[model samples]
Target: MDLNDLFMSCKKGDVNRVKQLVEQKEVELNVRDRWDSTPLYYACLCGHTNVVRYLLKSGARCEANTFDGERCVYGSLTPEIRNILVKDYV
Candidate 1:
């Protein structure tokens, strides 16, 4: 239920843990941590494609103007992820 757990789960690429937290806790998906990064941000930064997809599919925001948002694109490990963000943004 804690946001930290969700963030860690995403960063660790624990898809099941992320799924359980996102489903059971129903916490605000876009809630920023002390680092001003969201669950999706960590997922993207760590190049966890599945985590990023799950977050995006669950309505996570990826605005182009935001630092984290832009960084998500720059930090993504694959073009598929970048395409996902671009397509979603557009």
Candidate 2:
């Protein structure tokens, strides 16, 4: 029901709020917005790596492809962001 709230949190890059809502309220992580983009996709499209990491930590599915046929990585990330993501893996 509060899909828009999820989307807006993604847009604003509010990682803490997003986490709280998703954890407490059980909001749908994969809900597509009017633009047909899930929160993970939008976070990637916006290049918000911290937000992306938070979402990923919360089990947001990155495989939810958006209009560009790219994972969140391909659309908004550069080598710099790649380093951040990779750091977490290491």
Candidate 3:
């Protein structure tokens, strides 16, 4: 898949597809899209805690801040989502 497709999948929180693509090495985990976003960033933005954990375990950077300067965690999370993530992934 192309970079945009990969980014779209990441934005959609397609954890299985993300893992498959990454494992196949067909997609670069750290590749930045037009908006300068990594797969992990999109996953976090969409509140995919499971995806976040998986990506983090796979070496996706947790501290990649957004264009507006919010850390990946803070940029993507609401209070409820953050709590869930803290409980599950942190």
Q: Each prediction's TM-score against the native? A: 0.85, 0.72, 0.73
C-alpha local distance difference test of each model: 0.84, 0.69, 0.69
Candidate 3: tens digits of C-alpha lDDT, residues 13-41: 78888788888888867778777777777
Candidate rank order under lDDT: 1, 2, 3
User: Which stretches of candidate 2 lie above 4 Å from their native place?
Assistant: 64-69, 82-90
* Model 1 alpha-carbon miss at residue 80, Å: 2.6
Instruction: After the best TM-score superposition of candidate 1, give how far the Cα of residue 5 lies from its true spot, in angstroms.
Output: 0.7
Residue 77 Cα positional deviation in candidate 1, in Å, after optimal superposition: 2.6
In candidate 1, stretches whose alpha carbon ends up further than 4 angstroms from where it belongs are: none
- Scored by lDDT, the top model is 1
Better of 1 and 3 by lDDT: 1
Candidate 2 has an lDDT of 0.69
Q: Which stretches of candidate 3 lie over 4 Å from their true place?
A: 64-70, 78-90
Query: Considering only N, C-alpha and C atoms within 3 Å, which residue pairs clash in candidate 3?
Result: none
